[model samples]
Target: MARFVKEIMSPAVVALRPDASLVEAAQLMRAQDVGDVLVAQDGVLLGVITDRDIALRAVAEGLDPLTVSCQSVCTPDPVCVGPEEEITTAQRLMRDHAVRRLPVVDGRGTVGVVTIGDVVQDRDPDSALAHISRATPDL
Candidate 1:
């Protein structure tokens, strides 16, 4: 069987809300040690905000992060992938869009989040592979 995306994704994810302040988002990211957070509202996926978004879009542009909400800086409309999407498709999206993180969703709703590191981990043929083998098949 060919490898799939869900097989290689990280289950532990950090998420946030659109109403969250940029400062709040940054602190949360720092606390979680993650670069981005999946932005959701009422448990539905919306968009994602990253440290880079704050630094490059808000800070560099002289917007006050402490006063601004994640929705203000987050990519208004983010590219998304279903839990069942092909690994090849995901890779293409990341490469073409120049993004590093992607939020994964399933019928039950959001399942986990994946990153470039996740894909690289999948290639490790060890720790990640062990996890991959047990994942529910890609949708």
Candidate 2:
């Protein structure tokens, strides 16, 4: 049997409004124990905001998290994958885009998110992708 994005994707999505403050996004991440949040507007996916983006793009620039909108620092028009797509397809998309996660969407809307960690844990625990996915950030 083939593995699909839906099989390993995290369906409990934590999203932020485009107009939301980066502080709010950060709070959501802390509350959800996640490192990223989807930036959405009226049910439309706008972008992805990662913890790194908040740190590098906003904080490092001395921007006020209370004032910066999620959309302002998010990775806009992010690469996405469908729920039913093969896990390999998601991995390829992640590698090609230089991203660690991909939003999982369908005709209706975003159904979940797939991270390299998810793939590694579910499929190949010994692959290079798994190592990269599990590597500690250089900070």
Candidate 3:
């Protein structure tokens, strides 16, 4: 493992503020072409809103997306990981919680987001066949 999270983590991310409306958050995700958005304020981490979160947590509940704040439905005080932590650490957290995504934070601030897909995609498999079979695998 690397001394820091930069060694085994995605480098890019999408982030939003808890104060943002669901509509605004959705637009940010759309614009970024990402599946989730980190909810934060100032330099502090807050929660996460996944694309699935929008569909299942809000739309399915028949709530007004335009009026609801992402904070209202986001997984607040979300489980997070350090950038320097081992990749397996995050994988375990996801497996235990049955979560698809995790926010990555460093000393400066939020640096990236990791998903079950990213973990499986980035990890080396036992063999080449296994690697190819799961490369870009749908999670």
Candidate that scores best on lDDT: 2
In model 3, residue pairs whose N, Cα or C atoms come closer than 3 Å (at least 3 residues apart or on different chains), thus clashing, are 4-84, 5-83, 5-84
Which digits, one per residue and each the tens of the lDDT, describe model 3 over residues 1-139? 3334456566786777787888898888777667788888887888888888888999999999998889888988888888878888898899898887888877888888777666765674565744654455344
lDDT of each residue in 1-139, candidate 1, tens digit only: 5567788777777777888889899889888777788788888877889989999989999989888889877886677777688877777889999988778877777788778767766656467664664455442
Model 2 C-alpha lDDT per residue in residues 43-117, reported as the tens digit of each score: 899999999999999999999999999999999999999999999999899889899889999999999999979
Candidate numbers, best lDDT first, in rank order? 2, 1, 3
How does model 3 score by TM-score? Answer: 0.81
How well does candidate 2 match the true structure in TM-score terms?
0.89
By lDDT, the better pick of 1 and 3 is: 1
RMSD of 2: 3.1
List the candidate numbers ranked by TM-score, top first.
Answer: 2, 1, 3
State model 3's lDDT.
0.78
For every model shown, what is its TM-score relative to the native structure? Answer: 0.81, 0.89, 0.81
Over 4 Å off, model 1: 124-139
Best of the candidates, TM-score: 2
Error of 3 at 119 (Å): 1.0
